[model samples]
Target: MAAILAAGAGLHPARNAAAAPMPRVAAAGWAGAQTLLALGVVPLALPEIARYRALVAEPPLPESVQELGLRSEPNLELLTALAPHLIVADAGSVTSPLARIAPVATFAPLRPGRRPAEAAREATLALAARLGRDAEAQSLIAAHEARLAGAAERLSGDRGGPLCLVSDAFGNRALVFGGNSLYQDVLDRVGLRNAFTGATSAWGHATVGLDQLAALDPTTRLVLLTSRVPDARTFLALRPLWRTLPFLREERVTVLADILFYGGLPSADRFARLLAERLAPGNAARG
Candidate 1:
């Protein structure tokens, strides 16, 4: 049985004689939830599960975990009610508020120059250690790596294919993702070249008009990360530059479901698999 201790916040949940290693966890961020799920632990509570579903569908959240409200300003009363052993949250304003409820451990989102995939692996391992789920973490990491390697092997020949990843945020504008992003890491792992080699914000994206995308080689394959907001269909339809794009004209465009580009290994694996299935040779008839 783990001894009771007043570790900083308040009372750490005391372990029973036969208690499970991490009986109950409540993650205040989606990445934390994803990592916990990757370790085979269904969190007791999740932050914005419905919204998370729309963005990152894979490694789905089980119905059992309660919703903790908005990611930015989580409901403190609800979080306190969950009585989590640890609250895994993003490092930001949310942390201070959540810490009042339970022991808070934070993971930095979009750290500059850190490959999201690598950061995810480290975060998973670190979280696993904290929860005494090291073995599960190893298995999850191995599986993630295997999936990435398989995708890489299948798309090996597509290395030279100039690629551009865009998030359709507005009708006439897009956020170009590249440079130290998990998507870029996944792209490199899957042997695709990112055509947006210019500077990017710390989050690894640059908001540009649709016309700016055409600056890349005409043969470049454009992939859009889609979401509900700024509807991809409506945006593409309204944007004149989208119609004039060579890739769009030649049918070389691929649209991938919106994923948590900053999520843990599972998200990276999911991204890689999507790219491989859509862009791999013989997978799709490309012009």
Candidate 2:
């Protein structure tokens, strides 16, 4: 079936959505942390605060949050010292070593046969139910839906063509998100289509060479979510083979701001607004 034909965008999810200081919650990963923040709960401690500002870049992290060191290896000692009442992590191991410190909560990244947005909605609601914030979570989800609806309306007209969500390009290869990714769901929500129709892993992305991208329809535009990937435009500018891409020659590429590819609804919202602003008619300038 065509991706546009399959397109549709769901949860019981929560708390009173406040940024209060009590109950001292700590954030672990991008998605879960974002979920909590959307519920108006500011994490007492979050890893890589500086990097998150650049990557996640939305629902801004407060200065009150203590740095938890590396994202992969959160400073257990500091996190323990923080003595949080709850630890919310991304869809990683819920029974992680942090479980010993306090009750842990998490959100799953993917649910079989479920739309990414639906899974996100369910996970947010489930997590909120744990925190006794169902009402607040509902409000948050409603607001997010309203924003997405506005974006869809803004992009109701043709965007000229489909888009390809990708990360940095290197050595003739690039990370491309597939139909099951959060990016794909957001694209679908905004009435946009994904151009990369290839197999992907459980995480919904694959590393394919530039040769694969060079073969895409000439109308496919690129949206680079350069998280950890280095400056691709500069690198590709110096690579002779990069010139072979028709999208580049025709200037159909649209490099987006950094985003946590695996983040929750907030990430999707940021992307939705960006796409609407960039791809809407009479809006062809790049940032």
Candidate 3:
């Protein structure tokens, strides 16, 4: 299946063409950078470098990768100065300015109605082909499949815990992920049940009030998702009620990596594996 997808996607020919000589590449989003890294190709410029701190943790950025600016809006002058051979941006940023700077390729990490893991795989395979690393891309897909299979096997026995995947940044307002979102994908893969699986927006952010959350009640486990927001101390200080909630009291509140849920590449499988390990019955006690 992967071979057919790879061949149909034309990854091999594209990768071979790219490998004739190394080309300077600029990545404009977190997911694009991840795809480049997965292909064993480092971007000359990355706009959102800071958000990757939690993602990259202990390992330092390779010298080949340069910080350009925030992903929301990059420094055009700096990007122009880098003289990138190829500019990779998201669908939102594939503007004339970016195109004028260099040959721009727009890839979306999460398209409305598309599954996150499928998007990740497509993005990785596409980038690998474009960068001349088809073999590496194929290997990545295989590894992802194996990891996902293992996670599924480990989580197969779960009888479906009541789950709430929330993007809890502000105090009162929260966005719940459901429907076709990555959060839904992760929860499904881990054998957990989402309490809110009704209608969801294409962006995967559904604004819900505290009253709505409280109504979901004690039995439902809550997963808080944040991207390096307020310092941990400040966040804890502000949301004391969160810790006092019945779900938290029962130790059902789990904090997951926001980047993996939002800006993941083909590595969404890794996030599933981690969740399976963390949420699997008795596995937490064993650890």
Q: What is the C-alpha lDDT of each candidate?
A: 0.73, 0.74, 0.65
lDDT per residue for candidate 3 within 146-167, as digits (tens), equals 7777887887776645877776
Model 3: how far is 52 from its true place, Å? 1.9
In the range 39-70, model 2's lDDT, one tens digit per residue, is 88888888888888887878888888889987
Return the clash pairs for model 2, or none: 13-125, 14-133, 14-134, 15-133, 15-134
Name the top lDDT candidate: 2
Error of 1 at 22 (Å): 1.8
Q: Per-residue alpha-carbon lDDT of model 1 for 100-165, expressed as tens digits?
A: 777876755356556677667677766666676778889998898899899989887664458888
What TM-score would you give candidate 2 relative to the actual structure? Answer: 0.87
lDDT-better candidate, 1 vs 2: 2
